[model samples]
Target: MTFVHAGHGATMLFMLLLLLGAGAVGAAVLSRRVIGLRILDYPTGRSAHARPVPKGGGLAILVVFVTGVPLAQMIWHHTPTLADKTLLAATAWLGLFSWRDDMHPMPALWKLGAQVLAALLVAWGSLGILPHDGTAWGMLLGRSLWLVVLCNVLNFMDGLDGLAAGCTLLACVVTAILCLHAGAGVDTWGTALVMAVAIAGFLPFNFPNARLFMGDVGSQCCGLVLGALGLHMANLPPLAHGWALMPLMLSGLLADVGVTLLRRTMLRRPLLQAHREHIYQMAHRGGMQPATITVLAWAATLCGAGAACALAGGVIGLPAAAGGVLALQLAWAVVVIRRVRHTPGLRW
Candidate 1:
């Protein structure tokens, strides 16, 4: 299960710096050009912002990652397999539809269908390398659905400035570390590093205050890359059967999205419809500052990452880390719910 080490540390660092520069310049330019391009997201009843903002800033991330990672792979002399190539390709595939959606909204079905196809592409590529056992087809269907769900998970959570981007940046960093510890392929860690910096390049335009939103374009691309990397790690020999660590690392995000979706379904609300009932939204409505909420979310994600690493290292059992991650998120959820309930006009 040894993957040929891709490149020297110094070389990878140089490549990342180039990507960071490209992403920053690209995002800055896109932020300015989006207005001229007329790709603006107006305030909606479900929106957290009060004013219209230029959207599709994620195009910078899309372009930077779609162009940079493969080139890095080639330079490092690590020829990516068909699955690896497809994972990267699928990001651009989905980006096209999402970029268009940001400019002109489309039916939910259209976007969902696009996401499914992107997910299927990754799954199909993965199946080539995966064990051809009785469960292979099941894995294909399951992984495909997982990728689509993850795409929407990030999309669903992309409300406040810096939240989705910040959380994703941290997740990529954490996943990269785990990949290194487990000796996963360079394609896994390399993709993770590229994604983190790419988002880092975009973060300045997004966080503390947002001049540009990643919109569906940026968020969905983040989801696809993150999800695909998680699957890649799971199928690696060292991390095989420890797939739970992937989700554990993303506990805060999954909790927020999972709980929100469940509440909506229980209340008979439309699942696909956008709303501000997410726990982060509740905290915001309950007077939490966006920066504060985003930082708090980052902290929770770090805690989950710590637990995941502990589990991967056998410092803690899976059940303990799983329960700990869930408990931490549950505590945060309770705080948000109570704050919303205590607010004079707010409801949870």
Candidate 2:
């Protein structure tokens, strides 16, 4: 149940730096005015921006991941496995659909269908990677659903600049740390670091100021990869109790997306219909700066990560960490609701 020791710290460090440096350069090139003109995001009634901007900056991250991972495998003297190819292929499939959607808006049902198909691919691929439990069918269904939900959750939370991307970057970094602590192989932790730097490549243009947007292409890819990695970790025998790692790390995103969708359903609002009603969106509408809101979300995620790490270290049991996470989310919801209470036209 243990992993090959992740030796060659120097080599790992070089790989990380190479990915980051390349990603940053790619992001810079993609941010050029001529390049951005290829796909523009025009402001709508529900949009946070006031003008059209270049979108699809997430292409840099996608490119970095697609190339960086294989190179890392080579550097580590590990052969590329079928599972690795499956993961990349599925991500590319979903990314293609998302790219098309960003360039020319597609129907909600169609996008959802694409996401489901990609999720199924991931589930099927996981069967080979994860150790067999008796309930294979159950695992397949659950993993597929997990990927789909995360894909949509991140897509929903991508309303403001840097919100989704920044949060995901944080999750990747923390997940890598947790993976190392749990004695996971270099494949697990190293890939997580690659994802983190990939996102870091895109953040400079999207955060604080909106020079470019990641579009659906970047957001959905981030979600799918995150979901896949979380499932992989959960199936690791040594990390059996680490099942809650991702949820705890992404508590802010899950809480915001979960509550918003539930409230919409209760109010008879169309579930897939786009709107600016998320807690973060509501806070922004209430005059809070996007940077401030995103930072708050980052802080919540960091808190959750700390608690989750405690569970990983056996310092606290799963129940204790899970309870603390729930309490933290509830407190966050309360504070956000109170802050935006007086914002006109907000139902909650």
**Top TM-score: which candidate number?**
1
Candidate 1's C-alpha runs over 4 A off are: 1-32, 35-38, 129-134
Instruction: Give per-residue lDDT, candidate 1, residue 148.
Output: 94
Score candidate 2 by TM-score against the native: 0.91
Write the residue-wise lDDT of candidate 2 on 127-162 in tens digits: 775536658878788889999999988888888888
Q: 1-348, model 1: which lDDT tens digit per residue?
A: 123334466676676567656655765675666646666788988888999888898888888788778866775678889888898889999998999898889999999999999999998897876647768878888999989989999998899999889989998998888888888766888788778877887888888998889999999999998889878777766663467766887889999999989999999999977788899999999999999999998898899888878887778888899899989998998898788888998877
lDDT of 2: 0.81
Among residues 3 or more apart in sequence or in different chains, the pairs in candidate 1 whose N, CA or C atoms overlap within 3 Å are none
Clashing pairs in 2: none
lDDT scores for all predictions? 0.84, 0.81
